[model samples]
Target: MDLKPLLNKLENYHTEKPNRVFTMYLNTDPADPDQQGGEWRLQLKNGLNNFETYLQEDGDSDEKRNYWAVKEKVQHYINENERNLKKSVIIIATADEDIWFAETLQMPVKTEFFWEEQPQLRQLKELQKSFPKTGIILTQKDQVKYIDAELGTVKDTALYELDLDTEDWRQHQGPHRADSNLGSGGAKTSKKDELAERFEANRARWYKSIAPELDQIAKKHHWERIYLVGPSDEVNDLEQHMNKKVEGKINKNLLDHEETKVLNEVV
Candidate 1:
């Protein structure tokens, strides 16, 4: 999801009475130690119940009715999505449905609830800053894999391999699995070794060839940070040619790993 547009819209939103917004941030990660024994369920119930009790005691008729409507909707949403909840869940809505936004995010969030004229966005903004849109470039020899991610979740991915004949990078739909035998013990490595040898000879030029595409992808994805992970020489050579700044670099090949594993190890 693109946050720039959504955040801008939410930041300007305001209302009163019937349109009062309800904002919620729930930490639902089962692995989180604090959530052991399904404690978040009780927290959520208590939070909404507190709001209901307060509205019952002191709120005007419209305010109480609106709060009740929003409360029911919120309860239904949570129940429906409980099984699919991720590390966190965020929701902002009004009883009349003038505005509604809900998302299950891979990133963690502190549990909080608000009933106000505008959606509470401080935590969401913090998540955006902490886990901004990122492009992870993984390289080995003549292949490059790009993982586009935001808020700690993989968004999209593509593979690009340099065609020796054309000296041009060819985009592939998915990851290019690394050859398992390349570095295994006692295996004949003539073919791949020869290719790697050839690539090493003109490594600078080859890396330079793909650098422009990296910059292009970063621009297209609006990546705030770009990380390159691969052989030291590949990372250095590519950085020298690319206009985009490298946020981080790791001197090890990880293109063959699972997307989540690679992301955790690299960033």
Candidate 2:
């Protein structure tokens, strides 16, 4: 979800023709008071129709054909994904389909559309600024999860679990949905007190051991802000060992929750 490259691509995107690019920014959040009545549908209808009207008045047949082609595909995409629509939907496309960038983001966006030479990017840049790339670290005792996110949507995830036998951290990268193995290394029958005592004695040393790996991940993701979520004692210990500064800390052991829920709680 890094926007710098995409922004650069769209910034310089233009054609010798009069107008062939289409950009759309729709605020589809039902929770937003302004959008409670499903007004975006009407706005989109009117906005698109207004563009067609303008073209009919002053645009040529070739331009009109191109515009209609792009509009048909855009409308189909929106209709198909309307049920999964989040707070905002942003799309920038061209007539020939050489460049198509679309995203459904959890963040809000101003409802706007453009039929111009280049993509409308001022609002997009500001949105990225408000919720830049971030890493939300959820740590309990021996496990830490990193959520690589931008503009309130997750891009990637990595789980770091301490291999007690090797006293080394292991990294697993993907959308690992299960959190059953957080506190223990698959030792579900082990007594809670036993596990607690074992980690309590070596918590600081173990966390310190994995701190450098976390720093490496931070650099790899170019995280703008890091939020540590766990008990204050565990979070504080890990924060001390990390070279990068933590932007926020939440005192709650949320390792077993769903990632999106965990992200919502932490970030």
Best by lDDT: 1
Superposition error at 39 for model 1 (Å):
1.2
Error at 161, model 2, angstroms? 2.3
C-alpha displacement of 142 in model 1, angstroms? 1.8
Per-candidate Cα lDDT values, in order, are 0.85, 0.83
Compute the lDDT of residue 202 as modeled in candidate 1: 88
Task: List candidate 1 segments past 4 Å from native.
Answer: 53-80, 95-98, 174-176, 180-186
lDDT by residue (tens digit), candidate 2, 1-267: 568778888889887565578999999998999899999899889988998999899858888988898899889989999999889999898888977888988888898989888888988899888878889898877788888888888898778877766878888656653542334445565565576777889889999988898899889888999999988999999999999989999998787677777777766
lDDT score at residue 195, model 1, on the 0-100 scale: 64
Model 2 TM: 0.87
TM-score, per-candidate, Cα-based: 0.86, 0.87
TM-score of 1: 0.86
lDDT of 1 by residue, 1-267 (tens): 777788999999999765589999999988999998888899999999988898878758898889889888888988899888889989898888877788887888999999999999999999898988989998877778899988888889898878777888888645455553233336556886776677789889988888887899999999999999998988999989999999999988788789878887766
